[model samples]
Target: MPARARLADENVDFMSLMSEANRRRVLGKSTPVVYPAGTLLFREGDPARVILIESGLVRVFRTVPDGRQATVAFLRTREILGASLIVSDPPWVCAQIVIDSTITDLDVKTLRNVASTHIQVMTAVATQLAALVRNAHRLVALRSLGNITQRLAYDLLERACQSQLEMGRLDAMVTQEGLAASIGSSREVVSRAMKGLRAAGIIKTTPGVVRVVDPVRLSDTVRAFLRPT
Candidate 1:
């Protein structure tokens, strides 16, 4: 509708392709749902439905046959999940609430009907999918290029980017299990990587927290690993 037109008329965040009109339209057909942290929004292979993240953080992950869950990505407010519905059935991924969040289960059929007619809405959805694919590719590329220490450095730098440095120390809020899931490695491997960083005088660790001594030095170290070997 008019919201789609506004997006077409001006350049907006490329990742946010959906218009407010589309969001409202989808919400009108959705049932509001609230979940506390640790709640599972849906599981892998669950029936596909449109998910509108109204507020808060969601971790999308995959559970291996061995019951280990690997973090794929995180979604926050105003992001649309399961846009893969535009095609046949979607590629299902389980979502767990990382924080108390408000969301909605949008009627997939309504969204499809509206998006079928609105090019902008579809474009936004396509853009979101592209972003996810790009992130996955980046992960693959990083893995191809570095050792666990390098990868852990990159992850620590990423965590630092999202957090604040207090008195020359930055905290990485992740359990070894969670960190292992994020890095696609085992807890023991990640622990060794942490020890490497500690030995290098780059970081100090406590339970569920990593204190970065010098973010600049850490960034420099990560870059060294990222360079051609």
Candidate 2:
């Protein structure tokens, strides 16, 4: 709870849609849950509970036909998870939060109660749901996008290292195998693209971490695959 307490005290703006008052109000009643690396926050078919990320990361993925799990998306600080439950049906995906992460668990009723008094909060819910839809669309679009490698790269950078990307190891909850699953390809192909990026001085990889040494060049590499070659 210290982490979340510190966050609330700082009053740093994240979740742009929610006002500071509403954010604090929600966090006030929420219970803080901490988990270590590889902790499963929720699994496919589990009931979704409203979760506010105070710090750390959560990876959303689904099991595939080949007995491999494809990493799909992630949730970070100031972001809300299980937002879709507020506006639509339940989610059927597994989520793994990053190491030593703290998340505030709040139920749907409390959220609804708060949002009822605050239309702005309700608007935030709407935006969150819409973002989920867009992510799904991008997931489907990845398969159709030619040059799966480039598509993979673009997807990796889409939100892998959000907001504060720099020339250092990317602490993203993604990997080659996960990337293959996201773009509907094999790890071999994903690895080749990773190698190409490294050769081009755009990125460097070490085990599970990827450092974006040159963001502009990396974007150019992604663009190259997007256009007809």
Candidate 3:
């Protein structure tokens, strides 16, 4: 099937799983907004409001005490964000715009009220939180592995698979600096790693676009790194 058709099908499947009451509650409560490529949506400790990705993407990150930043998560279409603040009394991290993206901002008060009245909405929110925790643990595990390049290759390949399955292609609008931050490496290191992947025929990059060329091999490499010793 076509990429657009696949995207639509996936979206429909997602919506079909949502309860009708939850769907009605979400409607008209979210306001669509757009951000520039480099805009900072929210900072750590800033106020929290639920956001749904209408289109494009956003990166959630946190700043280290030493002043470096680390990317914690990537939010795409149909993904809900700001749950940390919604569920917790304290803020956990910051969110930033990785690319020019559109999002629907939902009022936290409204969401809280809906969650209080709708058991399904509350359950769904809890499920999403559990998934976030798992991803966080995976990142911690990845950080303990071989080298920066290896970690980056793992992250890139995993992300590529998700993007490919969701959008029917492996196209990422990421810079070397962004990849470095995500993988706990320097830009120079990420550059060298990109070169290595290109030489190995695993990926290709030009300017702002990174494309997966050999997804099967890339997946094998990631799996090998993740294997139990």
Candidate 4:
């Protein structure tokens, strides 16, 4: 997307709802920063700092005792970075840079003060937490699906709608390994699923891209997975 379009897509428009003083408070206290792809922003026990994404994406995950990492959720531009600090009494999970992204950091205390002064800011924070919870729930639910392909198709369709991208465009960018990790499956499983979709004429796959050809059938397959057992 164009920079202008991305900003518009991510903009929360808090200024319309917040008082000038509150807006100034946040802007004045915020510090701009950037992270290259794969940088670890914060660990599980690290002190929480309020962050707002200026551009790009980040993934939140938990490191298992065995040292395996499972993706918890992904955040994009205009989304808050340290959400665990916002909603929880303590830090919950680690956040890392999934893509080269820019962010603005603000003291959590400053954000709390702003939220205190603006009901809209408080509501925005609450809505963000609700979205996080919903994503966590959806990841858990995806685990029961028979295979990685089914889970990947569901995730792509859902995220495309969330990001307002068309299905074919979404498929063109999503990778098999990324899809596998998102659905808690192996890359081989995801690859096989892609092959199946290709054979059925539901999608076409290249080395790193999969293009959706039959959205109707894909939607039907996804719907069937959601039907009452």
Models 1 onward score TM values of 0.59, 0.59, 0.62, 0.60
Score each candidate by Cα lDDT: 0.67, 0.63, 0.64, 0.62
CA deviation > 4 Å runs, candidate 4: 1-21, 84-88, 146-192, 195-229
The residue-level lDDT of candidate 4 at 142 comes to 60
The residue pairs that clash in candidate 1, if any, are none
Off by over 4 Å in 3: 1-17, 146-150, 154-193, 196-229
Give lDDT: candidate 4, residue 139. 55
lDDT of 4 at 121: 69
Candidate 3 positional error at 5, Å: 24
Over 1-229, each residue of candidate 2 has an lDDT whose tens digit, in order, gives: 4433333222222356677888776666667878865577787878778787777766667876675666555555666777767667767787775435888886787777777888887777766665555555555454566476667666655534331222222344577888888778899988888888888887777776676665445545454432322
Error of 2 at 210 (Å): 11
Candidate number with the higher lDDT (1 or 2): 1
Write candidate 1's Cα lDDT for 88-207 as tens digits: 678668887655788877788887887788887678777666656655554457655677776787688556433432222357787889878877889999998888889989888889
What value of lDDT does candidate 1 attain over all alpha carbons? 0.67
Instruction: Give the TM-score comparing model 3 with the true structure, all chains together.
Output: 0.62
Q: Write the per-residue lDDT of candidate 3 for residues 65-86, one digit (tens) a residue.
A: 8856665665556766776556
Q: In lDDT terms, which candidate is top?
A: 1
| Candidate with best TM-score | 3
